[model samples]
Target: MLIKQIIIRKKAQEIEKKSPYILLFHCSGLTSRQWRQLKNILCTFQGRTLFQPSCRGKLPYKKKQGGFIAQFAFSAGPTCILYLIRKTPDNTWSQLLPSAFYKQNLVLLYGQLQSTLVNHMDIKRAVDLETVSVFQQLFELIFYPYNSLCFCLNQPIQAE
Candidate 1:
């Protein structure tokens, strides 16, 4: 798996203590740089770490044959989340779920994973399929109605 690491300094230790690390694994045909740029623009919260792993269908491996699989790793304090993103022959993206749907299941996973941390805390979290407008789609994809304290966004790409 090709991995790109991004580290952001926390403004306050209190924020870091409350924040949960987020891992956003995007689909194929997009470079880690693109994801990083989007993250920098959309993510305003502090004391968080981001990881973008370049899957097999992307750069340095796009030209190569066979299927591409990649994983994104996020670490915050003692908590960590892992999201997987893959590539399709047509270059589209999707989440890896039994039903292969985008909306409900993604949100279910997000809520299920971070329920304890987000119970009393107002932290926003979400996941969805990326649309045409990269920036707008990114924002829409992560607009969660839960907490406002910390935000955890996860995007997984499926080659279909």
Candidate 2:
């Protein structure tokens, strides 16, 4: 029984590694400490892995914001996305976001996670898909720039 249990656990770990990874980047006035409770609640599931970094000090990157973005891009591969959870004063979520470039995909999610805009599962399903929206024009294919516009967002888009 012990041997069987060990084998099962190993298999589960392997499956978890292959599962989708989501990085919930905390907004301004928030830190990794704030996410401690939430991480415990969200990471309990085996569907995906979550990482929230300590956005406290200055990073080596040119842009401080790029630090978290770089981490998510490298760790989660191309399928990784930085979820900006911004809640406005009037109670409605803000949609206007500054233009930014990422090695992978960028999703602007309005409102809180558990609220009305989006949920956890919705993100998993979307990233796991082949083709996704860029929310604008000028789609630059990272890997094969000459190939076509239809690029697989789920596949790993590593930095060259």
Candidate 3:
């Protein structure tokens, strides 16, 4: 059963080459080692950049995942700045936000609001909370001033 599960996961990862724009936000507490499989799979394709700048090996801050994805975007030869909205709702994923909505959404994404999907996902509540908190802090400190594009990817489940 474990072997079957691993095979399925690998197949899914391997087959995701179609959507180049997919934003991969790593779940926290997982090391870069966990990303090795993804890196290896991405290496097979040409003209694709698989950049993992910060591994946090012997770093001062805790080992969290956020800016690795954002930093890659910043370094991808773009001129504008970017802000990574780690906890924004799924709506923000598909559309642009107004000035007021941007500010408010940024706060809500970074805050511990029960209304957010972070509190209701299938994952453990404690783990989700810590991951969201870490994502907010690291994203602000590392990916700031790059507000040319603000990104948020939220996955909400139906209550039924």
Best by TM-score: 3
Q: Per the 3 Å backbone cut-off, how many clashing residue pairs does candidate 2 have?
A: 0
Query: TM-scores across all candidates?
Result: 0.21, 0.24, 0.28
lDDT per residue as tens, model 1, 1-160? 1121122222222223432222333222334444344355234444333323333444444344412321221211212222222222322233322222322222222222322322221122222222111222233333322221133333332233
Poorest 10 consecutive residues of model 3 by lDDT? 119-128
Best by the lDDT measure: 3
Q: Model 2 lDDT vs. the true structure?
A: 0.32
lDDT head-to-head 1 vs 2, winner: 2
lDDT, residue 148, model 3? 15
Measured on C-alpha atoms, candidate 3 has an lDDT of 0.32
Choose 1 or 2, whichever is better by TM-score: 2
lDDT of 3 by residue, 16-116 (tens): 43222222333233334433444444444444444333344654323455444433322323221122322344454244234323333232212123555
lDDT of 2 by residue, 1-160 (tens): 3454344345334433442222332222223333333344344445433433334576555365545434433332122223233222332212212232323334322222322222222322222212122433313322232222222222334322
Say which prediction, candidate 2 or candidate 3, comes out ahead on lDDT.
3
